[model samples]
Target: MNKNNQKSKDGNWQISFSPIFRYVAVFCLLIFATIMLGGAVLSFSQMKSNAQVLLSNVHAQTSQRIDESITLLESLASLPEFYDPNVPPIEKVKKLDQMSPYFDYLMICYVDSNITVYSDGSEPASLASRDYMQRLFSTGQRQVTDSFAAGADGVTLNYTVAVPLLDAQNNITGCLFCAIYFDEVVDILKQSAATSGYEATLIGSQGQIMSSTAGLPYGEPLMKELQNARVIGTTPDKLQEQLLAAEPGDYWSLQNGSLVYTAYQRVEDTGWDLLCSVDFRTAFLGILPSLLLVAALAALLCLGLSFLLRRYIAGQMHSVDLLVESVEKLEKKLYQDERPENVDFNEIIRLTSDGLSDALTGLVTRSVFLNQAETQLQKINPEYTSALCFVDMDNLKSINDTYGHYGGDVALKNVGYIFREYEKKYDGLVSRYGGDEFVMLLINLDDEAELRSVLEELVLRLHSEIGSAGQQINVQCSVGVSLCQPGMKLEKMIADADEALYFVKQNGKGYYKIHQN
Candidate 1:
C-alpha cells in the first residue's frame, strides 16, 4: 500500500540465467564439426596408402617374372647341337625336341635362310616373314618383341624372347626363339587383382590397352577413354589434361557418386603402365558402420546436454516466475494495505530493476521513466524552475524513404542518445516514448536561460555527431518545452508539452518552442 513497502516487494523477485549460453552451444557445435572433418581426412589418407602399397607389389612381381623368362632363353642357347654345322639335320631337330617342356613353343631359324625348325613336331612355318626373326638374322643379337606371329594354324598374338646362335669362327649360324601366349600373360595380371576388388589394366607405350580385367576391348586407345570420361570435381577437359601428365603414383577422382582411389606403376622393362583402382565406398565398408555409430552417440550426447541445460535454466528462474505471479495478485486489490509474502533473493531485484532500459540508446522506457520520475519529482523544491520537453525527429520518414527503415532507426537513436547526454549532465530522466519520439524531465533547471543553453548545446551536438552512425542522412529534431507547476499531474504536464510540440510541427520544424498557455 505504501511506496517503501512496494519497493520491498519488488526487491524479492530475483532474475537469473546469463544470455551467453546460446553462444556457448554454437561454439561447441563448431568444435564438433572440426573434429568430424579431421577424422574424414585421416580416413582417406590411410585408404590411399593401402592402395599405393598394393600397386607397387604388383609391379615388382611382374618385373621378376620377365627376368626369369629372359634367363631361360639364354640357358637354352648354350646347347651345342643347334649351333654345330656338322650335326645332321634330323639330330638338330631332335635337340629342338629336347627343348620341349622348357618353353611353350621353340623355333630355330638358320641365318640368311628361311628354313625353320619347331619342337612341337608340327609343320614348319617360314621365319623370313616375321619382323622379330628378321631382326635376329640381320643384327645377330638377342631381342624381345610383342607382335602377331604367323603360325601354321593361323596368326596368333605372342610375346617372344629370341637369342642369336654363333659358329665357332664367331660367324652367324642361326637363331633360337621362345614364345608365350598373350592370353597367358593376361592371366598373370588378372591373378594379382583377384581378391582386392580392384580393376587392373596393362597400358601399352602407345597409350593403348593391351590387356584389362575391366573388360575394355584390347588394343583400344586408352587415352580416348580417359579424355571422354566425365570426372567429378573437374571438367572433362581438365581431367584429360591431368591424365596426360599422370605418372607412377596414386590419385583420387569421383565416379557414380563414389570416390575412386587409383594407383599406377610403370613397368620400365615393357614400356607399359600397370593401373589398379578401388572404390572408396567399397574400400571403407568396415569403417562406415563405425563412423555411423560414433555419429549416433554424438547426437545422443548433444540431446542429453540440451535437456539438462533447459532444466537448469528453468530452476534458476523459479523465484522470478513466483514474483511475477505475486505482482498480478497485488494489482487486483486496488492498492490494498496487504502485501504479498517476499522470496529470499538479495541482488536479483537490482539486476531486473533497470531491465526496461532501451536496448539501442540505454535510456529508460516511457513506463519506467513515468514510474520513477514521480518519485524523483517528490523530492524537488517547488520554488526551483523545472521543465518537461517532448522531442520528435523531423527527418525520420525521409531517412526511411531514402536509406530504408534502418536509417530511420539510426536517426531516432541519435535523438535518444542526445537526450541521454542531457539526462547525465542535468540529473533528469530521459525515456524513449515511442517511434521517433522521446520525453525529457529536468528537475532543477535553475532558470529558463539554463534550459535554453542545454537545449542549444544538444541541438548542436546532435547535428555534428548524428551522421556518423553510418547512414547517409542528416538528423534533426523538433522540441516543445512546458514549465511544471505545483500539484501538476504528470498526464496534464505531458499534454501541455504535446500541444506545444503540435504548434512546432504546424510552423517550420527543426526548432524548439515553449507552451504559450
Candidate 2:
C-alpha cells in the first residue's frame, strides 16, 4: 500500500481505540488534579496558621484574666478591715462578697505559728486543720492547692492567697488567707470557650487541669497531654524548660485518624498554664466538600468533552467558571463575612472583649489608684498643690446587717455618685479605694480653709440625704483631709489622712478631721 493509505488506516485504528476527545479528557483531568492539590495545600496552611494564632491569643488572654483575679484578691487582703481583729469573720465575708462579684466563695484563715482559725466557718472534722495550718505557716506565700474530689461537688480545686496580717506593733499576727473556689474558675473557662471559639483549660504545675470547660474530663490522659504540649519559649525560664521538656503539644491522631493543632502558654506571675487544641477537619469544615465537588465535576466534564464536539468543551469550561465563582463566594462568606450565630469565631470576639474589660477594671482597683497617686506626687513641681481626702462610711456593716446587702449596695452606689459629683466640681479623681472607703484627689487646692469648708459641706449634704432616706438609717461619713506638700511622699499624706480618720472614727462618726502641717 502507498504511504497515504497506510496513514489513513493508522488514524482509523487510533480513532477506533481512543477518540481525539480522550486526549483532551486526560489533559483536563490532570489540570483538575493539580488545581485540587494546590488548593488543598493552601487551605491547610491557612487553617493551621489561623488556628495557632487563635490559640495564642486565647492563652495570653487567659493568663491576663487569671492575673487580674489574683490581683483583686490581693487588694482585698490589703484593706484595713482585714487587719481589724474586732471585725467578725462573717462581716469580712459579706464585705468581700460585696466588693468582688467574681468571687463564688472566699475564706480567711489565720494559720499562724500559735493560733489557727478557718474563717469560712469551721474546719472539717475529718481533716486535720493543724497539719494544714503548719504547712501554710511554713510556706509563707500564696499557693494553689492540688485538685481533690469534694463530696457532691465532684472535683474542686483551691487557690489560696496567703499574706501576713501585721499588728500595730508591726509584728506578724498571722497569715491572712483566702480560698477561691475552682468551680467558678472552670465556669469562667467554659464561658470563655462558649463565647470564644477555642477550648481552654487551666493547667497546674503538676500537669493537672485545675479548671476546664464543661464535659472535658480531668483525667490522667488529658493531664499527660497538657504536660507534653509545646509551649511558647518566651515564657519564664522555669516554665520554658517545663514546656519544652513536656510532650503536651505534640501532634496526635484521633481515633478516626485526624490530626489536630495545639498550642499552650504559661501564665506570667502565676504558676499556671493554658492549653488549646482544635482538629483541622472541624476548623475548615465547609471548604473541603466544595473543593471535592469542583474536582469531581471537572473530571466528569473532561470525560464528556472527549466524546462530544469542541462546542461541548466550551460549554463545560463555562460551567467550570461558574463553579469557581460559587466556591469563591462561599469562601468569602465563610471566612470574611460577619460571624454567624453558634459559630466558633463569635465566641472569641465576645470573650476577648470581656477579658479586656475585666483586666482594665482590675487595674483600676485600689493598688493602681495608689500607684498613680504616688507617681503624680513624685512628678509634682514645687508650685503645684494637691489634697488627699480619706472618706470612710461610718457603719457599713450595721447597715448591711439591718437592711440586707442590696441596701448596702444602694448606699455605696450613692456614695460613689456623690464622689463623682464632687470630683467634677473639684476637678479631681475619686476612687472606691476599698469597701466603705474612698480616696478623692483634689489638685492645686492650696487653700486649707477652703478645702476644709468643702469637705464639711459635703459631709453635711451626705447626712441630710441619709436622714431623708430614713431617720433610723442615719448613714454618716467621716472625712480626713491632708494637704500634699513639696518633697512629701504620697503614702505620708495617706497615713496622715488615715490617722485623722481614725481619730474621727474614735471621737465621733459624722465629723471631718484635717491634718496640720
* Residue 237 of model 2, lDDT score: 43
> What local lDDT does model 1 show for residue 29?
72
- Maximum-lDDT candidate: 1
Per-model TM-score on C-alpha atoms: 0.50, 0.42
Top of the candidates by TM-score: 1
Query: lDDT of each model, Cα atoms only?
Result: 0.66, 0.59
Off by over 4 Å in 1: 1-51, 85-115, 147-157, 166-172, 194-196, 230-265, 277-294, 307-517
lDDT per residue as tens, model 2, 1-517: 0011212432321123255656776787787778767776765675556556655666656555556556765676567776777876556655554544445444444443355443344452222254334554555455444444443354545665455555566565555445666565666566656653546666666665667652456744353443444433332344445564553342333423455555666666455666665555655563667777777888788767565765565577667666656755654565465422223332322433432311211113466567667765664444555688898999789888977775676566556656655764565666677788888777765566667778888898666344223434546799887878777778898899998889888997798888886
Residue-level lDDT tens digits of model 1 in 1-517: 0111222355444433344456546655765676566556756775676667667767777666566666765665667766665775566556655654555553432332343644345555566767667777788767666435445566677766677776677665666666666777787778777756567787765667878887888888876666544454555455334445555655566666777777777764455677787776666663556666666676667667766886876676676667666755643442243321221122222444556876655578888989987887776667677788888887778778987876666666556655755775577888988877889988766777877887777666555434434545687778888888888778877899999889888898777887866
Q: What is the lDDT of residue 200 in candidate 2?
A: 66
User: Candidate 1: lDDT of 242?
Assistant: 42
